[model samples]
Target: MKAAFLVPVLAALWPAPALSDGVAGEFDYYILSLSWQPAWCRTTGDGRDAPECQNGSGRDFVVHGLWPQYERGWPDHCETRERDPSRRDTQAMGDLMAPGLALYQWRKHGRCSGLSAAGYYAALREAAEAVRTPAVFDDLPRDIALPPAVVEDAFIEANPGLTADGITVTCKAEALAEVRICLTRDLEPRACAPDARRDCARSRVLMERIR
Candidate 1:
């Protein structure tokens, strides 16, 4: 009887055989690829500063369910996970620009958890920044000056996480001249100098870019 009881106990203690090959692989990939933190991503409609990064978990579902995976499907719906460490590092560094600690948490937990994908991407970016290496700033043409309103629109288009009124980009040249594009500090008026504003017009900044 003791042997019988012990046998049952041993069976219980023994790990259950992993699911079948197909199921096992699917679950493993799903777990690794899925974005567990849905709340981490920010939505376009809601004017949230530092919108949560789209939860990548939804993309895993699409991949599993014979759905099409596209960039359009990611924002406000799914998070993107970069399988490449270099790409992941790029994203994690971007996460540092978020306005609040919530993003910091998202960046932190996203990498540490079993759920992979975007989290891993973020982790890589974070790791890259920690190294304190200088990023090579790719130079662009300085002559191109878009209209103030257009520049404002472009700024908003570039960073969906900032407030709806990213920049009060007036069409009038004089008004445009007064309009300063701040970096990172979006809401603060007079935050950017003339030179910085011109630079903002040229590039897609993670924080606030004005015209």
Candidate 2:
């Protein structure tokens, strides 16, 4: 009888499990995801009227998300005390990412950063600006196929400190999707986690022209 009574008391005092993956502000590094807009349009963005897909939008690589990562795994939708971003905050990111995407990213990955919405967005902008997209991809007049390593090499060349170990290229439906780069909390280039280093294995992946 006494044991049963103590069980209820201890349960109440034990503290509730976090409602999410892990606490915010507790991550090893960051992954800056730059998505190939045209490839996205050809696949998931098809039939969608998003501005990024409009003709002559000139969007090539755009900010996908800034994710908080662990050494081995990653976290998402983590419980945090920071408030969600406001419409103004989301709109401010439109130059780099769609407003809706900014909001979604904030909820999913940004929340795990433990920064306020404004701070997270600011950090995202800083990270995006730090990466230099290869100029060769600026105006591909037509679709082309190339080894994924070539793309990674181009990025490595453009960004001096970045290397094959620090970045990985991803594909969807045989099309170039995103280039993910790992960085330290201070935003310096770092080697990605082993699991995060999975590069697209296709010898020749399609890269759609800029819309």
Which candidate number would show the highest TM-score if scored against the true structure?
A: 2
Clashes of 1: 14
| Local distance difference test values of all predictions, in order | 0.24, 0.78
True-structure lDDT of candidate 1 = 0.24
**Global local distance difference test of model 2:** 0.78
Q: Write the per-residue lDDT of candidate 2 for residues 1-211, one digit (tens) a residue.
A: 0000000111101112223377799999999987777776776465556554777777777777788888867788889889998898887776776677788888878989989999999998889888988998977879999999999999999999998899998887688877899999998999998878868888888999988
What TM-score does prediction 2 earn? 0.87
Best by lDDT: 2
Q: Write the per-residue lDDT of candidate 1 for residues 151-182, one digit (tens) a residue.
A: 45544454444233323332222222222222
- Give the least accurate 10-residue stretch of model 2, judged by summed lDDT: 1-10
